[model samples]
Target chain A: MSFFKVEHLTMKFGGLMAVSDLSLTAKEGDLIGLIGPNGAGKTTVFNMITGRLLPTEGKIYFRGKDITGTQSHIINAGGIARTFQNIRLFNDLTVLENVMIGYHGRLRSSFWEAIFRLPRYKSEEKKMRSMAGELLAEVQLDNVADEKAGTLAYGQQRKLEIARALATNPRLLLLDEPVAGMNPRETGDMMDFINSIREAYGLAIILIEHDMRFVMGLCEHLIVLDHGVTIATGLPVEIQNNPQVIEAYLGEPEGA
Target chain B: MSERHRREWIYKLCTYGAIVGLFAFFLQVQNQADEYQIRILNVSAVFVTLAVSYNLINGVAGQFSLGPNAFMAVGAYTTALLTLSPAEKELSFIIEPIIWPLSVLHLPFLPSLLIGGAFAALLGFIMAFPVFRVRGDYLAIVTLGFGEVIRVVANNVQSITNGPLGLKGLSEYTNLWWSWGVAVFTVFCVTRLVKSSFGRAMQAIREDEVAAAAMGINVFRHKMLAFVVHAFFAGMAGGLMAHLITTISPTLFSFFLTFNLLVIIVIGGLGSMTGSIIAAIIITHAGEWLRAVEEPMAIGPFNIPGIPGMRMVVFSIMLILVMIFARQGLMGRREFSWKWFCGFLKIGKRRG
Candidate 1:
């Protein structure tokens, strides 16, 4: 059975079709890339799959179970986690606390137990703290774990977002522009980091990225979109060579 | 034991010791202090409870709600109705007799207070359905409207709330022990909550609801949890206030009560429980002390008529000054810990 699938997905906002009839499937550890120009609804597809937005017409299945239109939290709890295009760390919380929040869905302690600091809650809390520490260390952020997340540098903030998402122990990860505002060195490091985490966790990643080199290098398969419709889908090389994808990216020649 | 664990044990011991010492002091004050002084202490303790609970929603959860007064009214009235004797209810509800079961119902103070809190929490649960749908300023408006609606209902529901006459001659069960005990318990519970995984979820929601949900936090559920807890404590404080003051009226739970609470939480630092406790004590005592500004004064034989509401004007100015100087309030989200306290003490010793 497919690990994750989206069928005939569509999203409309009032008069505008934000995404149209988008369909994709991923097996266990598949790294698929969704590439599109601005306003091509790449992020909207992620939003729908992650349940941030309800598809106008479509279904999403994860591990062969229908999860379409479920709440985003429920989707995450079902082992699908995502990061925002604009990093959304809990700014005021410490780096460790931000990651701890990722473990909240799986926490076993009841609210009253937490409030009373019962043995179960205490043990769970201790485990979460150490695990969050391990996550931060994995991302080379252990040194600054006590600092407020908002105080981190841009690249570190991006890394922290990934760390937080990974803390949720997701089987499928959606990354939106993982290297949106990084220099070449930072982008290269992030690429390696993403690959390492994917390998370590055996995660299937679907990412939206504008960097052609990064997307081509990291993603085994590519789906190109333009004007809310898929233009091409295949190996990165095939997507790169496709005339429609070229036209979508660089615009049609001066004349038709 | 490890050094860190040893330090933690010492800190725990110090904390418990401090609490015991404070309770002993309270006992002495209860026996020795003047009535007015004891009353001020009780009022301060009640405000501490109010400010900490109010901070949960407004400060920590980052939901701007202006409905604590309504919750408090629910608590105050519920407790008052439950605790009052049947004869007292009959006497107070002259305009219209209180409804049947409520009129006859009577409970001891502790149970009455708990029931009041439960009722307030129930109201919070119902309100959360609609209230959590909107956010920020819209939430504030809806809650503000809710507060007004409760007051209006209290005025019109003569049989249930005794209408405009309100409950009177309530027995004063709010002593130093009760008020301070609840205050301590409120602080403990809120502090524990803020340190829990659920607390992190709430803070995540505060930072960004979309991201929080994407990270697997049930945003609505956490929001509802904080709101219900907030309403519960606010109600309990209201119950304590009614018993301490020995009277109640619909007008008593007006927007001004909420405004005062807002001032306390704002001055306390939005997300800091320690800040709330300190600010509550300061504001409560400052309010009483500032009453002199409202009374006529003669300085150097120059008689001056007192200006009514002058104290509030001064308070507003203080708030503005605080905003200008300390935009994050006194603590700026930094909680008080034993380690910090020790460090502070060390600094003081070195200076001396």
Candidate 2:
């Protein structure tokens, strides 16, 4: 059995299928790329995997345990954290505060302990704050730690979202369009940051990226989906040459 | 924390010390000006309690409750029914049956007051339990309905509340002591609660309910916890009100009274307990001070007519202006913290 596996996942919004009978297996420490053109249902797969949406018909197994229709918080607590395609961060909160909030679920301090100013609660809060700062610094966002998240530039906001998800201490992290609106320079910088965080944190990552070069460079394995159906799943080279995958992307436009 | 923030902290400390000192001065009966002076102090203390408790629900917990007076009524009736003597109660025809069974409740004044408070708090918890599942405007409407339902029951249940005629002639045990003590205790509890992890959870819910829940904060549990705690203090304040006036009527505890408490908190600051405390003192004393201006005025060598209800008109305008300019209340969302200042100076607890 794979570390994470999805079988026969089908989700329908009315008569239109958002995801259709998709099945895949992700082994431990796999850096997988999920790619397709616009409306390829890449994010829908991430949502289903993260338990943000339930499969109309399917089973999801994480580390050999079936996890279907679980709450997002619980799934996150169970070692899966995800960012949205649009960067859904708590924008009003300060950058550091946003990251600290991500650790709120994991902090182990009793209510009475905090009220009484127990040494343990005091030290734990301090440690968590320091850890949040470290995470922000990892993404080179330390300078804007005190600023409201909404005040950050677009690229910085994307980095902060990734840092916040990392604060949850997940075994599996999903990045939806991690570099959607970045210049080539920022795109390269973000690609580097993602690879470094994965190696340092020892966490498996599933990424959605439209930039073919960036995705191909980082992903050890690849899956191609078009119109809510998986057309190819193999090594990067195998996926790049698959005629069915070619037709799906080719069907939408012309040539190649 | 900026230099301005440091100075503001020192100013706040001095103001608190002065306020406590002033109250201590009032406690000395020898310093009393007259019957009216003592009465004003008593009213200030009650307002302080109500305003602080209101902050617990509205500011720290972020529940927009408009039901303070209803809880107050519950406390007043409970205290009256528990402590009044049978013969004395019969003279009033108000709450004879309830007190007739509680001869043991005649054990001193303070204990009876506490028993009444406990019952009122229990009633508050019962009322808040079901409504905690919802949020925002829906919860507000449910609580408003709860307040009305309590009032209707008080009106029609002649055997209990005396049916709009109201229970009266109970013992007048409130003075500078019970009122001021509860006021001080309310400030203490509210301050402590806001500093707790539970308080942090509540504020998180206020900041962003979805993120707070994703952080496993148990949003509904904390909301209910705050609601019950707020009800407990509101009920206690109500009991004090009944004793201060030495009379009771359903008309006294109405939605209008809730609106007045709302004004008190709004004028101070929403989330700041200190703001609420300061605002309470101002509103209470200011109402008394208004009478002198509103009453008949005699100028030197001339007579001037005083306009009644003019003060309320002025107060309404002041509320509107405050909302426009200082909408976060007097304190914004931050509590008064000396340590945060030290952190900013790079000398104390490290801040992110």
Candidate 3:
């Protein structure tokens, strides 16, 4: 069974079809790339899979269970976590607090227990704290765990977002423009961190990126979208050689 | 004992000790204090409760709500109906006969207060369904509308609320002990909620609702929780206010009541519970003390005729100045903790 799958997914916004009949599957431990120019519905796909947006038509499955249009929290609880293209850290909150929020879906303490600070709440909170610390450390942000998220540098904020997503203990992780605004060194560091976490946690990652080099270098398989429709899907080498993909990226042949 | 165990013990001891200390202090003050001082303290405690409860939705949950007074009205009216004697109820509704079921029923203070809070919470829960669907300014307007609707309903319901004349001669059961006790409890519950995972989720929702949802938080549920909890406490505060003031009227729970709470929170810092507590005290006391300015004063040789609403003018100026200089309010999301307090004292366990 596939680890995660999106079959015949389509999204419409008024007159615009944001995603058109897109289908992809990720096996356990696979790294897939969804790439396109600006406005290619890459983020829309992530949004739909995470249940932020209900697909106009689609079926989303995680480990053979239909999760299409499930409530966002339930989808996250079912072990799918995602980051946004625009960094969305709880800015006024500490980095540790931001990650702890990601652990909310896993917490079991009842409202009364928490309000009263019962032993169960204490233990669960402690466990969550340590786990948050670990995730912060994974993203190399443990040293600044107490710092407000808004005070972090842009690259660090992106890392914090990923750390927060990882804190959910997701089996399938969707990263939207993970290294969008990073310098080469920061981008390289992020790529390495992403690779290490995937290996360590046995995560299947589907990432959307504007950086072609990062996508080609990291992703094992690629699906290219243009004008909301898939133009190509295969290994990076095949995509690099495909004329349609080239035309989509660079526009139509000059002579024509 | 282990360090963690020791910390827990210390926490428990400190909490109970503080509660005991407050009771002893208030008990002494209740006997020695003048009626005016007691009244000021009672009002201050109610404002503290109101400010903290308001912060739960506006500050912690990041929903711009403007209808706390509506929930408070629910609590106030409910409590009044429940606690008023059948004879008193008949006397209150002089314009029209008191409703059958309400006129016959009466409850003691504590249970009546709880029921009032519960009713307010129910209203809050119902409001959240539509109110949470909109956000920012729209959320504010919707909630404000809810508040007005409540006021209008209270105005029309002559049999129950006595319409314009309002309910009077209410039992003054809200002593400083009751007011401050509930105020402390409100602070405790809110602070605990803010420190928990649920609190974090609420903050996350405040920061970015979409991102919060993507991170697995049930945004609507947390929003509803914050709203209902806030309304519950606001309701309790209203109940306390009614008993303390010895009257109930539709006009008392107006937008101005919410506006007063808003000013306190804005001055205190929207997301800071400690700020809310401090600001509540400051605003309430300041308003009382400023009464001197509202009265004719002999300054030097000339007797200056005090301007009516001068207190409000000065207060609005102060609020505007605070907004200009300290945009995040006094605390800016910071809370009071033992470590910080100790650090402030220049004593044991200095913050590193």
For candidate 3 chain A, which ten residues in a row score worst on lDDT? Answer: A131-140
| CAPRI tier of model 2 | acceptable
Regions more than 4 Å wrong, model 2 = A10-17, A36-56, A64-66, A86-94, A107-109, A133-153, A223-232, A237-256, B1-23, B28-30, B85-96, B99-129, B292-310, B338-352
- Candidates' RMSD to native: 1.2, 5.6, 2.3
Residue-level lDDT of model 1, residues B27-124, one tens digit each, is 89978999999999999999999999999999999999999999999999999999999998999889988889998899999999999999999999
What CA RMSD would candidate 3 show? 2.3
Candidate 1 lDDT at B72 equals: 95
| Poorest lDDT segment (10 consecutive residues) of candidate 1 chain B | B194-203
Docking quality (DockQ) of candidate 3: 0.82
Model 1 docking tier (incorrect/acceptable/medium/high)? high
Candidate 3 has a TM-score of: 0.95
The models' CA-based lDDT, in order, is 0.94, 0.80, 0.91
Candidate 3 per-residue lDDT over residues B215-327, each given as its tens digit: 88888989999999999999999999999998888999899999999999999999999999999999989998898889989989999997889899989999999999999
**Cα interface RMSD of each candidate:** 0.6, 2.9, 0.9
Which predicted model would earn the best TM-score? 1
Given the true complex, what DockQ would model 1 score? 0.90
Q: List the residue pairs that clash in candidate 1.
A: none
Best by lDDT: 1
Interface RMSD of 3: 0.9
lDDT per residue (tens digit) for residues A194-249 in model 2: 98999898889999988888888889999888889888888888888888887777
Residue A218's lDDT in candidate 1 = 95
